[model samples]
Target: MTTAIDDPRRTGYAAEVVANTLLDLARAEGRQLTQMQVHKLVFIAHGFTLALLGRPLMYNTVHAWKNGPVVRRLWQHWGERGTRPIDAPLPVSAGEPDVGSDAEAMEVIRSVWNAYGGMDGVELSRLTHTRGSPWSQVYGQSADLIPNEITREYYTGLARSA
Candidate 1:
């Protein structure tokens, strides 16, 4: 049976794969991304995927952290680097789905990079923290998880307006 990762109808790559894909994209363009930047990029890519592709990008749950939307696992993976640029890719464990191989997901990721990759962490934070953003809605409330339904809805509206 095809699992979510192997299913073509979904793009539930592990957060590590998603982060590493973003890092790889940055590296190819001769730049390194900070931990915070990676967090924000992954979140943005996920949002866009939901909007454009009508599917989730990664299986990871995004939390409305104090700063912005964050995949807790991805945060911990590179959080120790603080504001410094992450110079290396996180190792993807065996049996994980490959981000590069997923054409649809890669298209979404590359588009996100083209549109938002140049923005720094603070700018990305501002984008995600804007009024009515998914993070903004759940930030001060008791809820932490930025539900996919909410995310999909918010981004769908953005897509329509754009």
Candidate 2:
């Protein structure tokens, strides 16, 4: 039985689907990304999706960690890679529904890649850590979750300004 979390129409694509798509884009450009870079890119793309399209990008939870916004599932899945560039795609686990079918989502990921793909993880982290950024607002506070509403509002402001 598929729940709302697993249904792309209800929530969003699986984080791995998003991550794998990002990795694929990087590979096509002859680039690579550390786990940190992957996480940040995913979060950034998600934020933009929420703001611009008024929809979520991934079902995964994003937490304001010390480094920056992090998708917890991605953190654990790619943690073993450390600072090394991830060279391969994430294999879809058994029983997991195949996704990445949303054209709008793919376009958003592609746009994010074209915009921020060149920067390394450190640079991306610095961008997300900037004052008034979604991560900056809730980080170090009693709460950890970087609410989607906050992300949408912040990114919406950014879009309007840009």
Candidate 3:
């Protein structure tokens, strides 16, 4: 069956653009990127997107979990210990923010990376699962089957791409 990972809008346009931006960012910072490196970069972008949207990390975590055991372990470990945002109010804005802009979204990605030491996908996923205390509150329940499907489709795509 097709999965969210198979959706071009999700895994192709949005995810790929973010991944490329991250790769460029890492290179600008003098970091070398491997295939897995690209994978991690994309993962971080996905996580940052969720955080900025005020959405739970469920989908992102599930995506990471499908990547590999390393990802799953990362989620399990970091999701348990991550820090959370304290209740606070945002200043009233005159209009809705442009959530679809890449430049704006990239800022959030950079912020998350800076706050977490620019960890790779595997490490970041692990950290998020373990150290992202706020995330845990939202990730109270696990969705086992969904993640498996996501992971399967992702790997299958990778294989086809290879």
Candidate 4:
């Protein structure tokens, strides 16, 4: 009875497997997920995996909140005790220790990336400014420095080729 739908090797069947599994789980738990919710879950799960694997975790904590259940489950199952909270809010400020120099700012970036599940440098810069951090203030004062790390050149090239 190996119909196309039953053939796990096929892309369509593989997708069906995942879809059925999710639907079955949702039905069993009496939970429903919208398309947007599912997209957010996939995005955050990818980000979390990248982070744990030492890849550049490029997403925002708001995205993390969208995937809170997955993060909570991962933490509970694998993460160390006290490493993170079961229901933690995203960090809004650079607490306590002052970032004094570029070196310090880089460290802040790393910590923010780790804590917030990563954000684009521009977004991170904006968030720091929003929180009234000294680094953000200094960066805001400087008109020369480009906030985005991805670089205008790369974007320009892509746009030109397109």
The Cα local distance difference test for each model comes to 0.88, 0.87, 0.41, 0.30
Query: What TM-score should be assigned to candidate 2?
Result: 0.90
* Worst lDDT 10-window in candidate 3: 84-93
Model 4 alpha-carbon drift over 4 Å, by segment: 1-24, 54-162
Lowest summed lDDT window (length 10), candidate 2:
92-101
The whole-model C-alpha lDDT of candidate 3 against the native structure comes to 0.41
TM-scores of the models, in the given order? Answer: 0.93, 0.90, 0.42, 0.24
Clashes of each: 0, 0, 14, 0
What is the alpha-carbon lDDT of model 1 when measured against the actual structure?
A: 0.88
Candidate RMSDs in order: 1.7, 2.2, 15.8, 18.8
Question: How many backbone overlaps does candidate 2 show?
Answer: 0
Q: Pick the candidate with the highest TM-score.
A: 1
Candidate 2 per-residue C-alpha lDDT over 103-159 given as tens digits, one digit per residue, 9 for 90 to 100? 777788888999999999899999999899999999999989999999999999998
Identify the runs in model 1 with alpha carbons over 4 angstroms from their true place: 1-11
- In model 2, what lDDT does residue 85 have? 83
Model 3 residue 10 CA deviation in Å: 11
Q: Write the per-residue lDDT of candidate 4 for residues 1-162, one digit (tens) a residue.
A: 657543322211111122223333444545543333322232332223333333222222221221121223223333443322223222223321222222422342343334533333234334333332222323424332222222223223333554
Measured on C-alpha atoms, candidate 2 has an lDDT of 0.87
